[model samples]
Target: MSDTQAGQIGEDDHGHPAASKARLRLWLKLLKATKHVEAELRENLRTAFDTTLPRFDVMAALYRAESGLKMSELSSVLRVSNGNVTGIVDRLVDDGVLVRVPVDHDRRATTVRLTNAGREQFAAMAARHEAWIDEMLGGIDTSEIRAMTDQLERIASTNAKREG
Candidate 1:
């Protein structure tokens, strides 16, 4: 291997480069791309709706569940702590965007669903979000999209296998 390749891999046992170096580089590139897109999304959400990304994510999960979801379910679906969700839910409730209903036959349990106004507001945001994503990824062709999607799916499967 060349000096640069050796530097990248940090020198192998026999003084050659390691095989895992390419995978490490790929992981960093993927992380960078994800952060770039996420930063743009955060800025757009802030400027267009005067809202944060976490608020948008919570609404999105509630939007998908027409019948609403329990507090635990919301936490699990959003992959966030209950405290994080509770703060956002409280703000949204104060804004008249979500309504908390006592679960049937269970006074101790509460479920959250979007109000009519919330539905309408989310629809508007969702439309703009879709457009923003399309604009950002507009340069990538359909074939490349399909190829990348397939590769990512394979990677996910490999990761799942390890966990399982």
Candidate 2:
């Protein structure tokens, strides 16, 4: 049985344990909030930068890696298929935002890294992204945000323990 189902021996029409129902409601709320934020960001990215979120995500991953990453490594880190990574990498390369270099020892392998221009471009976008996020979440009280973060961290830790 799944971790959630383990507590379902006496579930009702509404899925009792009250805690379970509460968690389900919380999950839905989280999903809705995430979608709302993402939709805004998606529209803003297109309007402001003419870039897709996937491209931004790929660039963000590359920015995090100082030495760049292999195509396969990028795929793994981004939780995407190699073909998906290839397309983004191709476009970025064409835009002079990134370069693919052959590995010295591995003739068949190549690594993708951001160029200086890419770094500058992404840095600008990242700052704007941060402001967007702040604006999106500006309505929430700071204390409530802190409390929610702490609760989410506890849930994350619990899930990590279970998965580990």
Worst 10 residues of 2 by lDDT: 3-12
How much is the lDDT of residue 35 in candidate 1? 96
lDDT tens readout by residue for model 2, 91-135:
999999999999999999999999999999999889999999999
TM-score to native of every candidate shown: 0.88, 0.86
lDDT per residue (tens digit) for residues 35-134 in model 1: 9999999999999999999999999999999889999999999988888899999999999999999999999889999999999999999999999999
Please, what is the whole-model Cα lDDT of each candidate in the order they appear? 0.92, 0.92
For this target, which candidate reaches the highest TM-score against the unseen true structure?
A: 1
Name the lDDT of candidate 2: 0.92
